[model samples]
Target: MSILASSFHEGPLLDKYNNLLISHERYRAMFDNIPLAYMSMNENAAIIDFNNAFSELTGYSCEEVYMKPFSFFLYDKKDIEYHVNVTFPRFKRNGFARNQPWKLKHKSGREIYVIVHGNVRYDTDGRFIQTHCLIVDVTEQRLAREECQRAESKAQLILDVISERVTFHDREHHVLWANKNARSNAAPEC
Candidate 1:
């Protein structure tokens, strides 16, 4: 007999129990070790559990966040209002929210931009249980985009100030942008 068969004379009952234990362990390992931040909140939106990555991302210990409202970390009043009025209601209705961006306040008072995915959980009886959320820190990505936009705006300003007529066109031969001189010098379409 195989070791598992020999060890468990209780047959399928013990096998099922063992399988459940193994599955639970695997899920716990994944939940704790995944690089992205993960958290679960109670039906009232209070934090119930979170992973080490979440603690590190928000700079708050698990103890500090536990039992606190999820909105406690929102950086702005308007954001809090939006979450309460818009996001939560939509999540409740749809049971899932994907890749929605929000700003959270880090413990050190820095704003952390994150893209969040949330799913509402229900009991076997269809009663609401809690919400599970995955948070990906996108602060660096957002800042980089802002910097690029600023650079483009500065370049456009330089182009506009020059005396030369400059126009930018897409591959389809449609004008995307034109410097001030180019716009002023262009003939009216017949």
Candidate 2:
């Protein structure tokens, strides 16, 4: 018999319960398949769950992280202390913390930057139960920022050369840029 048909004969409570289970499964599927790193911790700051993307980024399996103190992955002593001792406690008291950029050491000994949003979930008696994290790896973004800086430096060097008039722009039919050597060798008119 169809599950919905069975629930219908059982009563509204059964039908509602079945629907809730289905909804939870759907949400779980979406979470597991997400392309970004996702992690969750207990109120005690112990890692409880993480997604596939988290493993891909960190080079650590979910099994290695689960039930362990998440602070173990942090290479910065100050950051580790702040996150485990200060931030989680403040979040438990505050209910939520917005996106905060963090630097962490990966299993390969490379430092990666991530933006994290955390929220504290509470039990019925108002005690903190879990901390949920939505983490996004920003290593590529950091690299891009550095690349832009280098490109700006190179452009400045080109401008400095141009500003000295050591380079010349020539046009008759087509425009051409010539360096000091090329300009000195080219015919004055042509």
Candidate 3:
């Protein structure tokens, strides 16, 4: 006859409520144990929490980063503004930001390139309380792109020199890609 007893009698609703709680717990566990670097920060940009992958990538223990200002590791002043003013505000307003590249300096003073995905969490009143992020180191990808550009430039130079038509075929039937003078002298028939 009591209200509490009546609620328990609502078996279908109780089952749904229990299922929702279980689903939420499973989601939280997955978020916390994800393989990539995951983190959350307060509105002041202080690191509130991070996962195991974060510690592994930055070489900092969880205890060391907790409550620390996220920008403390930013060696470049430009990066501080870029993250705080531009990236953070937009992310906080939009609820999500993705693949923003950062040149992050570690505790050991090594710089690493990382692409970050972030989301802002709001309290019941719809006020922003925390920002969560997932990070992936992209230094190798950036380096590989730069190296490919350099090699392409070198190959272009070789092609430009070969266009001069001054070189000739070698005795082994391979084209001698040399200076214009050598090609002109060797292949006078052309």
Candidate 4:
């Protein structure tokens, strides 16, 4: 039902159809440019199809990955094994999995970290048909976190070896961490 009624649309339905058609065309123009990668797999877990973002993220052409097991793109051996043996089966049973971590290797051998959100489709009779999934690329975020960890570890190691008393604290002045010398100095005398 449309908002303007009095005379009932004021004209034929052609104007309304034209408005809808124009709106759809504008949306279709943006569809291919969306940044979130999308993919779908058959019930067998084969890579059936993916969007342009997926192709850009993995550096693989549709022809190259077509019909391959989804796990085949994983970067680590353990991840591949776990996906095939655990995650896939769990998703099939649950019909949905969200924000599941995965590491995919690009065609150029770069590792890409991602969070997968997926849902399975079923036939009217309840047989599994396929899965629709979104792949959120998180490689830069993961790399930054790992880098920060390494930096902290290196700083801690240096602090541990120094003779000077060093302590880290929050704004409240409570000791959060104290290096070896700082710890010994704070200890009570026997």
How many backbone clashes are present in model 3? 3
TM-score of each: 0.87, 0.68, 0.67, 0.80
| Order by TM-score, highest first | 1, 4, 2, 3
Rank ordering of all candidates by lDDT, starting from the highest? 1, 4, 3, 2
Candidate 1 lDDT over residue span 37-138, tens digit each: 999888777889999899999999878989988799999999999988898878877889999988999999999999999899988987778889999999
**What is the per-residue lDDT of model 2 for residues 1-190, given as tens digits with 9 covering 90 to 100?**
9986776779887778899999999998998889988888887778888888877878888788788787887769999999878887887799888877788889999998988888888889998888888888888999899999999778656765653544444565353554554556657785
Top-TM-score structure, candidate number: 1
Per-residue alpha-carbon lDDT of model 3 for 12-94, expressed as tens digits? 77898889999999987887678888889998888988888787777788788888877775668999978788877788889
Scored against the true structure, residue 171 in model 2 reaches a CA lDDT of 62
Root-mean-square deviation of every model: 4.7, 8.9, 7.4, 6.9
Q: Which residue runs of candidate 3 sit more than 4 Å off their true CA positions? A: 1-33, 165-190
lDDT per residue (tens digit) for residues 137-186 in model 4: 99999999999999999999999999999999999999999999999889
Model 4 spans with C-alpha error above 4 angstroms = 1-30, 188-190
> Weakest 10 consecutive residues, lDDT, candidate 1?
4-13
Q: What are the clashing pairs of model 1?
A: none
